[model samples]
Target chain A: MTPPETETETASGEGGETRTLYGSPEELPEPAREALGDLLLVLADTKRVLGIHYADWILGSPTLEAGIACSAMAQDEWGHGRILYAMLDDFGMDPERLEHERGPSEYRSSELLDEPTDSWPELLALNLLLDTALSVQIEAMRESRLEPLHHKVSKILDEERYHFEHARGWTARMASTDRGREATGEPFREAWRACLRWFGSEEDELASGLAAEGIVDAAPGELRRRWVMRVAPSVAEVEPHLVQETEDGWGSAVDPDWEGWEPRTRRLRDAPGPDDEAILSRVRGDRNRSLLGE
Target chain B: MSDRLVQIERSRPRGEGTMDWSGVAAATRGDRPDLDVPQWDEPAADLAEEARRALYEVPDPEYPISLVDLGLIYDVTADDASGRVEVTMTFTATACPCIDFIRWDVRERIREIPGVSEVSVETVWDPPWTADRITDRGRRLLNRAGVSV
Candidate 1:
C-alpha cells in the first residue's frame, strides 16, 4: 500500500519549500543518527544470522538446485551484512567488533532465525515470512532522508528480489500437498509471530522516531502490515492460526504477543536470545582465524 | 548541520495504490550525493579513457568477456596529475561468488594503467543490471560462448 506522505515542512526547511535530503551520514542530526545506527544494527545482525542458517543448508537441502539457491542466498545475505556493517562505520561503530566480537546476546535479529531449521519446509517458511519481513523494513527506507541509503538500500533490495521469489515458489509448492502443509504449519506460525512481534509496537519510540525523522518512510506498525500483506496469502492454507483475510484483504490472525517485548534489543525480556555461539563462531570465521591475513 | 529534525518525503503518496517496490526493475532508484559523482569530479578524459581501455581487458572470473562488455564497469575516473583512478562498477549478481576476485582484478588491472598511483573499485546497485545493460560486444561474445543473450 502507498504510505501517507510526510509533509515537506516537518521533513525539510522551515518554509516547507522543498524536501532536502541529508547529503551523507555525516549530516544526520543527533537522535536520527542514533536511530539509524540502531536500525542498521538490527538489519545487519539479522542478515548475518540468516546467512549463517542458509549456509547450514547448502549441502543438505532437498534438491541440488535448492542447495545451489541456498549457497547463492547465503552469499547474498553475507554480502548484504557486510554492506550494512560498513554503513554503521559512519556511526563510529567498528565492523570488526560488531561482526566478530559480539555474542548472541547483542543480536537484534528476530527470534525465528535464532535456531536452525530442522526441515526443508521450515526453512521455506523462514524464507517466505522472515525474509519478507526484513525486505519490507528495508523498503521503508527506500526514500530515506539519509542520502547514502539511496544506493545502499537499492542495491540490497535488488539482491533480495530473488530471495522473495525463491521463498514464494517453494512455499507454494510445499503448500500444494496435505503432508507438506502439515509440515510447514509450525514453522509458518513461528515466523508469523516473529515478524509481527519483532517489528516492535506502535508505542516503540525508536521505530516511530525513525519515521518522524524521515529516516524510514513508515513506522513499525505500517511495516508489519505491509509484511502481512506480502506473506499472509502464502501461509494462509497451512497456518490457520497465523493469517486472516478480511474485506481489507490480508491481516495478522492474532495480535503479536508484545508482553515481555524489549524495544531496545527488539527481543522479549524473558526469553533468552539465541545462545548459539557456534553460529557466531562460524560467522566470525573462528576456525579459519589463523588463515585471515592483512 | 542543523539539530532540527526534518520530516522525510514518503516515496509514494497514499491513493497512488501501487506496490512500493520503488520501481525495483527500473534502471535507477534515487539520488546519491555523497558517493563519487562521475561527471562532477571526473579526472582527465584521456586518463579516464586509458583506465576504461585497461578495464576492457580484464575478464570476469567465470566468463571470458571483458568487464566493459558485460556492463559491469559503470564509470572510470583517472587523474593524470594525482595518479589516482576510481572505477565504479557492479557485478552480474550481488552474490557473485567471484566478487572479491573481480574487485581484485579490476583494481590490479586499473593499477597497471600508466600514471595511476591509487586504484579504488567501488560497487553500486542502483539501475540494477539486466540483459539490456549488456553491450553489443558482450552479446556477441556470450553468443560465441554458446550462452544465449
Candidate 2:
C-alpha cells in the first residue's frame, strides 16, 4: 500500500506543537503503520533466530573462551530481540503473543538464519555478514522521525559494537588458515547474498513508503550500500564481488537475485524459519510457566 | 563498634551547628557522658577504599581475576548520610551471561561493609570495555590461568 501524502495531527507533547507526520504508530497512515510493524517483526524474529543459533554453539565451540564468547553473543542477541519485541506493543502488537506463540511459517526472519549452523565457519558468516546487515538497518533508524525508536536504536547499536568486534576477531582468526579460509568462503558468499536480498529491491513499495514517511532515515539502496561498505573490509578475502576497490575507495556493487523475493518478509523465497519445536522450547520456557513474576 | 558509632555521627546532617549528643548517648545505652565521639568530618575516601577492597574479593566467575582487578568496577561511591553505596561497572562483553552473578556478587560483598545500608550497581557500556581496560594484575592472573588477555 502506498502511504497517503496527507498527514494526521495527533496529541501535542512537551513543546505543545501538534505532530502531523509519523509522530507515533497511531498517528501514521495505515500503510506506514503496517510497514513499520512488519519491519519490527522482521528485526525481532531475526535476532531471536540468531540468538538461538548462537546458543547452539556455546558448549561446542573449539575453545573455552570461544564458548564463553558464544554465550555472550547469544545473550546479546536475545536481549536485543526482547527489546525489539517489546517495542512492538507501541505498534499495537501483543509482544508476548508475538514472541511465544509464533510458528515457523509465521516468522519474518531472514532466510540466512532459517536453519541451525552446522559449522563454525557458517556461524562466523552469520555473525560477521548477516549480523552486520541487521545492525546497518537498525543504524539507519538512529535518527528516525519516530521518536520512540531513538533511545532503543542507540542502545541496541551500542551493544552491537562488541558483536561486530567479536565477529571480526573470529573471522580474521579463521581466515588466517588455508583450510579455514576455504571452509568459510561458501558460507560467506551465501550469507552475503541473503543479506543483499534481505534489504529488498530499491523498488519495494513498503521500503519506499516507509522511507517517504520518515520512519527510517535511508532508502533501501542506501542502507544496502552502507552495509556492504562496512562488511566489505572483513570479507574481502572471501569473494571479489563482495568488495571492489575503486579510485575513490573500496565499495560493493554485487547485484543479488531479487526475483521471487517476498518484499514484506524480505526473504528470497517462501520457506519456514527455524524448527518450531526447537525455537519454542527455548523461547517459551514451559518449565517456568508456573513461576510468577519475570 | 566504634567505627559504627563514628559512621552514625558523621551521617548527621551538617549546618545544624551543634548536634544533640545526649540523644545519641542515650541511644547507645551508656550512662557515661564521657564517650569521645571521633571526628565526624572524615572524608568518604575511607568508605570508598573499603568498598573497593570488598569488591576486590568478588572474583569473576569465568576468570581467576577479581572484578576490581579486571577493571570492571569503573567507579565506587558512597553517600555517608544515607549509607547508600553506588557502583558503576561494566562486563568484559555486553553479552556476558554472568552479568547477574557478577552484579549479585558485587552487591553482596559491598553490603557486608558496616556503614553500607544500601548498594546499587549500575552497568554502563559507554567507552565500551576492551582488553586494554584489563589491569596489569588481571593480565598476570589470566596468564597464570593459561588464558591470553
Candidate 1 docking: what grade? incorrect
| Steric clashes per prediction | 5, 0
Off by over 4 Å in 1: A1-17, B1-45
Could you tell me the lDDT of residue A144 within candidate 1? Answer: 81
- Give candidate 2's whole-model lDDT: 0.72
Interface RMSD of 1: 8.8
Rate residue A100 of model 2 by lDDT: 71
Q: Write one digit per residue (lDDT tens) for candidate 1, span A39-150.
A: 7888888888889888889999988999999998999998888778877777889776787777777888777777766789878877888888888989888878776675
Q: Which whole-number lDDT from 0 to 100 does residue A288 have in model 1?
A: 68
User: For each candidate, what TM-score against the reference?
Assistant: 0.83, 0.64
Best by DockQ: 1
Model 2: residues >4 Å from true position, as ranges? A1-23, A286-294, B1-149
* Native-referenced Cα lDDT, model 1: 0.73
Model 1, C-alpha of B87: deviation from truth (Å): 1.6
